[model samples]
Target chain A: MAEIPAALLLLADARLPAGGHAHSGGLEPAVAAHAVTDLADLRDFLHGRLATTGLTGAALAAAACAYAAAYAPDADIPPSGDGSAGGRRGWRGLDAEADARTPSPAQRRASRAQGRSLARAARATWSHPGLDALAAEVRAPHHPLVLGAAAAAAGGTPRQAAAVAAYGAAAGPASAAVRLLGLDPLDVHRVLADLAARMDEVADEAAAAAAGGWDALPAPSAPLLDLLAEAHVRAGLRLFES
Target chain B: MGAHHDHDPHEAAPPAGRALRLGIGGPVGSGKTALTAALCRALRDEYALAVVTNDIYTTEDADFLRRAAVLPDDRITAVRTGCCPHTAIRDDISANLDAVEDLQARHGRLDLVLVESGGDNLTALFSRGLADLQIFVLDAAGGDDVPRKGGPGVAQADLLVINKTDLAPLAGSDVARMERDALRVRGGKPVALTSLRERPDAPEVAAWVRGALRRARGAAAAAP
Candidate 1:
């Protein structure tokens, strides 16, 4: 078995100060709508979300890991960084792909907002040429792309990046559910533990799909999530951004 | 996944710019929003300013500021806290930082930017990364004993405002004891007693804010 990067732990931790705490990963709206009121409904929601948004985000992160792995900080690249035109175009294309996958405008905004926050934290934590290149290309790179680049910066493989992405997809909302509903936190952990194997499976599938190239990355859609995100924006009283 | 990690105690100060960022935080109904509005009313004519409010459940704070007409509509922005107000202000200040930067970019230059936190507990305090100067407000009606409790806000905030002084008599709370306890915990930091309903302009707190702005400006200028 290959050794895992220690820095992957920091990437996976929810307390990295990257602004992930402010977002509910669509759980806020679900709770507000009474779609998820208890632990049982939460389990179902996580399962479906993991299968759809989780998988898509994981695949994108894996693809982004590939791009970031190719960046060599020691290389005597052009001062313009933009002069590495191919890399610039590549990152932009990946960001656009992420936008394409997210059908909800509100979700896209949230993703990009998170991406922007993660970009700041990632750059401050690691010195990776790919991160700077991506930042130059897209001011607010997609969250998954930043995760993937950060993973690569931390010496993690595409698979590890996918794992982190998939875990966050469910964990963010699970934590939010605990806070919003006052559910037993112990039971929430049990639910996350039960989904561990499935999360690994989704990450594996995403890592496998990543090899097919960015254009061929997963683009799964969850129409209900999209509608929920939009509805969250219009909510007169909301505790979450999306 | 459950292991605890110690956050760095030395928070890097944000790059000094044209504006001085002031953070106001305290418990619900402690008048953080009101103080922010009062500051806006007092300082808008003197300085190019804007406000960012962290609203936990609604945009009521932002809406109230708008209704008060202290600053123009575009000058105020609201950030949702996702039910964890402390996290937005202390742990992960990205959303608030985004709003602040957006305001600065829009205005080109601002003299002061007030970031009002969502009403939270005494344990809540602003991150040094988010605020150049922080003020923690406490209402006299909440409990005079609260200052004696001395959480991080009371102990570390640059300024402590013991507000709603007029209610002290009605609530049977001792205003002098609140100030004494707060000062005792604060290690000589300035504490102001305010009655916004009576003064309306928050004269003492606003004066303290003006002093803070001056000291911040002087520090920024002195930095090599």
Candidate 2:
């Protein structure tokens, strides 16, 4: 019965101009490897991604939300328009923890790249100190951290941040599959629709784990996805950054 | 929850002491890259220069610049556009920004940095966030009516270049008509008519860029 922020839709909207459109979320490489060729293959790919990176990202976002909201009440200071994030120091450790969780250099770069872009968008969209703090503390906090901070700024709870993370984890790839493989838009939306319940379950797990601190956040890894990302960098042709 | 900010077109100044970023964008096969290379060759001797190219598929544009040896192997950085070259340059410019900043960091204090968009359509215009100024290139061979059918790239870009004028007579394209139409749509903004085949050095475009760089640096100095 918890309320979702009206602005959460904006944050999760693909049209928000966070530069996520230029990334296929590793689906391009999976397609290159012929691991995802048909609707069924894509569904399986989505399931695997939702279980792995999706779960990890949701936990990180939930943890970031918990961290930010906990600090928000006391930091009633005005926003820093000069791109400063004041009074929020807990984000850096979470960023480092994200670094440790991601072993592949390519994935780290991708995450940092997405993080930096998200920071710019979130700062411009929301006036919360958490965003400026995150921006100042972690010049490039992982994408989910910015998402979580943005969620908090939008007055959403940890569960909603987890949900946004879970949605992005699957949504970005589903959209990319349409572009890269020329798959039917309806079928891909159906695939995402079918995963809704499972997505909710994962988000709940992430939110439940929120109060346990950064170390306690979920740490799911997809080895094949990482390998595919590494391979995608040297790939002869690509439409996505990772 | 948006920030209370000015709606000024050039809001965020280029990173302190960073190179002036000039975007080159136009339709596929419009000679955007050719002009970029030509400008590079013409201006590299006078200024510390670099290029960031957005490619929809592969690194062909960057590769071409490298093959031509216009600046150097390292000065050219290629960014993937996820098949939407317009989004990378205009709506969501983070990737292109990263590429440009990376090049500027690697080679410090560049006088000019050209961010060339992947060959895109007339709707593709570089965001002011990415480029300090933008140049939209159109081939006269594209048709004399292209400027008449003005889009954002044709109208809003800081400079417009109607290139490939040598083929105008052969292609039956009236350069004078296109020039007149471009001037009308652009509200007296600067427009150049170029034939890269004859002027491979892109001297006129180079002069425009040099003036922009001087003004950008002056504005930065003029800033508080």
Candidate 3:
């Protein structure tokens, strides 16, 4: 039998207890308001989310990991004392773009929360100097940044990192939907399985975007999700954050 | 999976030694923030205390505590969960953990870290990984039936608190029945009836926390 890479296993373990279950990815309000009602609607919602927010987020995370891996040899990325790394100019730009693309304040906060959580978990489980340095550079690490650092620290390829990020983005909301809409667990599993089957394609897109370099990153454009996210923020009776 | 197996040897060591983490959760307008403030006032002089508050869109809870001067601003950190309060405390606790570690790193010796979840549904409860003990607070304004409804917070929290007992009569809530249902659902896991305005000290609740901390310290000392 072939030896399983512990990094992959660790990243894939749903039970690692990273706290990914509470977020519905704005699907709660979408479902509550009847914007997403059935399987077909769910598929569309997932597709839209994957193409826009999911695609952008996965690419960013992959790129962040690639940057961390590429720059690992240079321990001066944060620039001692001055706190400015000439080599990190591209990464700074990418982080800014991510911030701008995430229009909803709630979504941005959620992403940061998840990012910091991933960073803490990685720090506790795998204390890589490079990862720690990156976390320190950004006082509030974003999710993709942490995922990228973790992936690199664990020696997982950029593709694998993107795949994990995509899976988590889709699976988290789908699981929430199962509880929110009272859908069957088996049916939710089916949705996740179907989503999982497309992991390679999503990973490829993310990988390609990352390879293109941060300067040539894609533009952000997911208006409906943003609107739903905004609406969710105003809806006082909401159960999910966006 | 390939990822988990590959990194097994590179994993970092567990936290050296730490005090018990306590989580405070409850519904909206349930006096969770007030309870946190009161606890700080009551425990700060005796035990080194740090607090983490989760707010959906702002740092209102942390701001409130800081403004109240319960502890220095550095002793408290706020997590903007963005969506569900449950996600910050239960689903994903990285932010919360970082806040706790930051406090401990700066203070050097913390006896307790209190995590207050943003106002949420009764289903919300802290994950064991995030908190050693959990407190669930509900108010008379939510009605007496809330306890009987038996959500995870009421059924599973290590300690349940029904706040605003003073408002029960005005709101037509039965504080006695609420207490009865809470004990019934919790199977004897201690419930405290508190009126933050009337009894900010809440000696009984404070004693419970003290006892829990003592037991936690003993267990940690015993660990190999």
Task: Give the lowest summed-lDDT range of ten residues in model 3 chain A.
Answer: A78-87
Candidate 3, residues A73-100, lDDT tens digits: the string is 6544542221123344544555666686
- Give DockQ: model 3: 0.21
lDDT of each prediction vs. the true structure? 0.87, 0.84, 0.75
Tens-digit per-residue lDDT, A1-242, candidate 2: 78666898898899887879988888999999999998999999989998988988898898787667765757553332211123223677778767777878899988888988888888888888677778888767788889998999888988999999999999999999999889999999999999999999999998997757566667889999999999999999988888
Which ranges of candidate 3 are over 4 A from the true structure?
A: A1-4, A71-90, B1-21, B24-92, B98-113, B116-129, B132-201, B207-224
Question: How should the candidates be ordered by DockQ, best one leading?
Answer: 1, 2, 3
- The model with the greater lDDT, 1 or 2, is 1
DockQ class, candidate 2: medium
Q: Model 1, which residues run further than 4 Å from truth? A: A73-88, B1-14
Candidate closest to the true structure, highest DockQ: 1
lDDT tens readout by residue for model 1, A1-242: 46888888999999998888878999999998899999999999999999999999999999888778788655343323121223545788888888889989999999999999999998999999887888988988889999999998998988999999999999999999988999999999999999999999999999999877566788888999999999999998798887
Chain A TM-scores of each predicted structure, in the order given, are 0.93, 0.92, 0.86
- Report the lDDT tens digits of candidate 3 across residue range B23-99: 99999899999999988988889898999998875677888999999999899997656365787787767667767
- Ranking the candidates on lDDT from highest down gives 1, 2, 3
Worst lDDT run of 10 residues, candidate 1 chain B, spans B1-10
Worst 10 residues of 1 chain A by lDDT: A77-86
Which candidate has the top score in lDDT? 1
